[model samples]
Target: MRRRLSIVLTLLTVMMLGVIVTGLSFGEPGAAPMDDYFIENSQSESGANNVVTAVLFDYRGLDTLGEAAVLFTAALGTTLIFRRRRDD
Candidate 1:
């Protein structure tokens, strides 16, 4: 029963993944107007030479900080998990 359930869940996961991939593959590829606006004005607005840096650090600063915090927490958790177990 356990093995059958595992197999069913695995098949469902693969089917869901295939459907997601197929849906994404059919998306229209084009430059959005917002992207063009950002490219044209990012340097002047943010005073950053690199547009990507300007957008990430200036426009999306809070989101970037949150991502960094999450990464730091993950690293700390991994380090703790892998630390030597001292036999007391």
Candidate 2:
């Protein structure tokens, strides 16, 4: 019963995620004013020659930091999962 309930819950969660993702539409009107602003002024504002780098490291620094933290946590979790256990 528990296994069946878990399976049903998993399916429901996957379906919900699919619906949510499908509902998200990119390139709608006024969907991305930031993109235009970043492309136009990233180099001037951040003082970096590369617009992409300036945007990533300066304009979106906190978002990049969050990504790094998530990657680090995932890596740590994977390492811990695969590490050998020693009985001392």
For all predictions, the C-alpha RMSD in Å is 4.7, 3.9
TM-scores, in order shown?
0.67, 0.59
In the range 1-88, model 2's lDDT, one tens digit per residue, is 9999989999999999999999997777647988788778887899998878998899889999999999999999999998999999
As a TM-score, model 2 comes out at 0.59
**Among all candidates shown, the one with the greatest TM-score:** 1
What value of lDDT does candidate 2 attain over all alpha carbons?
Answer: 0.91
Please write out the lDDT profile of model 1 over residues 1-88, one tens digit for every residue.
9999989999999999999988874434545677887889999999999989999999999999999999999999999998999899
Please give the distance, in angstroms, between residue 7's alpha carbon in candidate 1 and its true position after superposition. 17
The alpha-carbon deviation from the true structure for residue 70 of candidate 2, after best TM-score superposition, in angstroms, is 1.6
